[model samples]
Target: MNLLRSQLGRPSRRWAAIGIASAAVAGLVVSLSGCSSSTTPKAPENTVAQGQWPSYYPSDYGTIVDGAKKEGGELTIYSNTDQENWAPIFRDFQKKYPFVTKISANNLDSDEVFQRQLSESATGNAPADLLATNAVQAWATYNNEPGRVMEYQSPELAKMPDFAQVMPNVYAISMDPVGLAYNAKLLGGEPTSIADLAALVSADPAKFKNKITTRDVSGSFGFTVSKGFVDGNTDAWASLEKILPSARPETSSGTQIEKITSGEYLAGFFISSAVAFPAQDKAQGIFKFVFPKDGTVVLGRGIGITPKAPHANTAKLFIDFLLSEEGQNAVSEGGLTAYRDSVKPAPGRHTYGEIVDQAGESAVIRVPYKITSDADVKAFTDKWNGMLGK
Candidate 1:
């Protein structure tokens, strides 16, 4: 299937003529004689003129299309992921909606995505049109604040799983799994689980000492991933006790992937597939990752439109597009796991369905999107820090 033409079909000659005439009437262009003189009128900014929308999409979705066009086609996003990761998604969105003239996306830490939004909003400045991050606790807090998130139920919701709708307005943009990463050349054997890594470290404490890396559990991203894995597996803490002494904690998945690839760290566990999978493609043959045989923790990167969105209509269009099948494919191409069952498979790309198939449904533990009380966080952090000898 041609990705470009799939969502937006060819415009009929009749509609094309109508579009041109409308533009002429609006003074956007003037035609003389049988010859055309001005730049071609922008494609009609409605569902009928652009192409067929999904059958399941609401019939009134065209209103959103028209509203977005009037908003000057500008969108701002606050997310924890790098811009490079959003390149393919942004490109495809622009192709589908050519009138979207500008998009500003900022890559920030998970907690900072909301922090910045709150700060900006408090100062009477417009905040992001959309917010996306894997910080579960941060999301819970942000959602609790009145008027922070726009309550929108997208037309794409019908096709998504129940879990995809994390909260009233928030939805999962990607279902990313956390796994073990290693330097294939430096590690003697492929470690498939925490137990396997524990055995390796126990056997050769000196060699593996300070060569293992994992996330620092103090940060939101780190804490959520670490806690998710530990809570899901009964023996996780037991295995980490044998392994953590030999491990160093890092603050970000990018750092963990780099260290593993450089052989600075022989192995890293609970590393995000979203960041690791793309790098593994360029690691030659030294870097590899495995979804633990014991269990794999899947975390959803949640997204929602802000209540004070400067371009609210444009934001709505973007949220719907991201949840659509075409958007899911673009997301996978951009190095994030696409969960839609309809998305086709590609090398190095994975879907939530594929992960469940490979890992077994029982072994694929998903972290629920909910608030973590301060007490619970402290208790978990204390235990995790204690194991690390911090």
Candidate 2:
């Protein structure tokens, strides 16, 4: 079957949809401050309160906004967050802080964001105000790299449960659990486990061959999913080995779901709800998604300020907004499962924290395991690549 020719839907245009909505806001900042983003600070020593962030009122938030406005309201971000997912968030932020005139969000997937941070380091140009990404690449790139990420203990930190903070510098903005999606019209039987997926495929390998979809473990979000699978369950890899032969590798959940919608593929494993939720609504009832009982994959997507961000105050404001109840509301509307449990549950899907509650703690495997075992990550990646016919 010619996958390309038979395609009926294209991937979501999020990557190309960066919102250039800050020009006016930027002008306002310039008019107000007569200062450039260069006025923003460089290191922690130059920073204000390190941990006393998002203060209740006049003391903290007011100061932050005033500082941000003076810094030119221009904040650039490097993240995998899609335009459709983040546009509302950024817009809402701009509405709240009209002085923020320049908000540019570049749509880079996790791997690309990680690599770019490195490139910036080499050239000594860390322009991004913030870094938003999954734990896999985020931790790999910033956690160990001593001075790369900034530590802002936003008062939002005090509200979040200790576990929600991925690391000292990184805070979980939202989470997208790996959902099992199958063509609704094509597969009627609800699968409760990965073994069920394998059995279904084993039953009809011909139809399933090259028709199944999963993260490409060689890179992208797949790298984290692969590692999380091994760390979570011993039997997970065995089930994947059963399905990999017929599965087509896709680095993106967006493309995988497009294939699933188009009938080029029938199912997608470990797909992000951020992508799946949008596709489900856009595909007109063609897709059905559920978390598996054996163990569902959960990716905690987080953010942190940069060490030498050009718009440090603006970046902090953005981070504060992201962790705020209002900002998280925008997060849910964007499609991904939200991180904050306090954020009221949406109509159809609840916050991922609640989802985890309903699924039972034992049934969920949070990806980017807290324990970063390099040897284990290496072993799992190697095994996954080998299974994928590398």
Candidate 3:
């Protein structure tokens, strides 16, 4: 298996399909905005007041807000994130739209989110109004089918960077950086990069054996980040060759964090800041994180509304609000790295800008949103597992 063959390639069929539709939607959105034409939907007379909406929003953006309130004021989301992480965003969203009476958000495995969505939608049962995950490969496959994702464009698109909009309606809710985490009390010195960690492990293999952990690349989240790291810096494979012998791969970040905090594990590589940042306070200074100086893989948590969403309007509102400055801040508060430049920095919270500033723009490796061919995935997985001696 050649790592060079796995570098981010052409946009997948799903991306191309969505890209074409996005162009058409852009033209249509411009024409429809502020249009009093009979075909245009009108905001209901009882629509809630738009308080402090940014000046850049289209004049007719309120129609969607009004429509959402009429749709039973409920929203359900299926995502691969903890409920605690969603709490802040949920609290702030409902505060903005008091009309929203209920929100049901589930935290499931990365693949489980799509499995449930596909299964539920097939059985003619209502599925999630929105879907969120970091599994780019899974998302690409899911969107290959027509109508799997809604093609609506957000009014806040202009405010975001090109990378934020992964495909048509799909957007990145957070830009999370993957890094190394350690047990501060147990680790004698700070290791700034994978190579440094490898050097330390080489110094005392017995002390690190089975004590260092990383994501099991069999899973999408693990595979994506691990592959991203290697694709960005080929030198990572050399360091990993030295470290994997002493490493124990885990299926979840929670387990890695828990063991590291308890000193069961000495350190973990390719750990997500989204999971690690929030755990720091509870760890009481036991767990610490570092953005690898060699290269930092920044992964975008992909989110989009489902075409069959029971509450379509509400989902639309949610997506737009997430891209807004306030929503981005709430995302950061929830331990996710907010990507919007307008978002203010909070103590101990990370933003994409901050990561780039610290790691150097050239050192920031963005995991591209593309479909990995099954053969390619298998080849990569086989080689990766072989390295881990699995």
Candidate 4:
């Protein structure tokens, strides 16, 4: 089977398309609504036991365990993303695996997470069983020190296309096509493009001063913005930096977005499709998200088992569960998935493609990848911070 690529900037019904292809192979091709990978049928309910499954069972990681037992153990995962958002999925998973005795999940800043992981591993203490974080840092940590992450292929992963599993050890679970977000009430109307909004922000410093928020140069959102500037056309960058003086940078994307929603800041320089739009839908008035005609950046968060994981078996079980149809449904409900091939943006979490369609040709940008390496990222951040005098 040919591996299909994930289309980030455009809204391709890849998920629905793949379903049709599968049905065609089975001699029953047809177009369907809300019919995606999530709706795919499961293996026979009582077909195989957990321990008897073959290794590397599927091309991706789809057939490791035919079925998992309701067994549980303790696990500590060190993650940079919010655990509260992921809590519901974990709780549901607990229903399936009632034996899980203890679970420790903490949300920390990505930079500190990297520092601590490196520091702790230097010593004898292995503080985590699962490592779910921004792709760049995770890749850096795993590559900087080989054998730090174990390779246990889960069957559920095989259901995903090749883009979902970039590395055997790293499972890229969620993709966030990030752009600028604004408070609809304050703006009177949404800007036609990012450049236009930035110009407006720059022209009226008194009106928008300190009302523009962006992530600290050290975080992933900050990286997203910098990469955007680098990848965007001349007019886009010119307008983007015009608002730099009115901006206040925060340590986390959530904080930056919160400030924007509260009117403490009128807009965020870079916003995730998952985080920004979903939060807006719950707000009292209209709020808007913008993906300029320029391409938007797709930041994927990868989840994997740690190298020195004490609860290795349990950790693998958790990864498998996350890649399952049930788990992916929970993810879509939470408004964090950006893969056009699987779960799409829910009602509240506006999509990247939607924003671009609204902008038309004015929002000309490039979708930037290769921002995951340490040297490249450090250089980019340094240049980006210098622009803000940080």
- Please write out the lDDT profile of model 1 over residues 1-390, one tens digit for every residue: 011011101112110111112233233221111122133232222122133468788888888888989997778888765554466566667667768767777656567677788898889996579998777778887788677789899888889887778877999998989888899999898887878989999999999989999888777767888888888989888899998988888876778888988889999988877667666666678999888878899988899999879899889888888888878876776667888778866664568877777667787888987777778888987787777733
TM-score of each: 0.83, 0.78, 0.82, 0.68
Candidate 4: segments with Cα more than 4 A from true spot: 1-72, 114-123, 199-210, 218-221, 232-236, 262-264, 273-275, 338-340, 344-383
lDDT tens digits, residue span 1-390, model 3? 122121211122111111122223123221111111343233211112234467788898888877887898778888766554565566666667767767777656566678888899889995589998877777777777778898888888899988888866789999989889999999877898889899998899889888889888777777888888988997988898888888878876767878999999999988777667656645667888888888899888899998789899989888888898878876776668899998756564568988877778888899988787778778877777776633
Better of 2 and 3 by TM-score: 3
Lowest summed lDDT window (length 10), candidate 1: 1-10
Stretches of candidate 2 above 4 Å error? 1-61, 121-124, 202-207, 347-350, 369-378, 385-390
Give Cα-based local distance difference scores for all models: 0.74, 0.65, 0.74, 0.55
* Highest TM-score scorer: 1
Task: Give the worst 10-residue stretch by lDDT in candidate 4.
Answer: 1-10
The residue pairs found clashing in candidate 3 are none
- Give a tens-digit lDDT track for model 2, residues 1-390: 001111112223233323345443222221001111243322111012322334463464667767887896678887766555565566667766766666777766455566677788689887777887774554554566577788777767666656567777787777778778888788646676777888888788777878788776656457666567666877886788888888777866767877887888888788776656545655667887777766788877778888888888888777777777667776665555667768766443337766566556787887662544557556766676666522
Number of clashing pairs per prediction, in order: 0, 4, 0, 18
All models, RMSD in angstroms? 12.2, 9.9, 12.1, 11.5
Residue ranges of candidate 3 with Cα displaced over 4 Å: 1-52, 282-285
Error of 3 at 304 (Å): 1.0
By lDDT, rank the candidates, best first. Answer: 3, 1, 2, 4
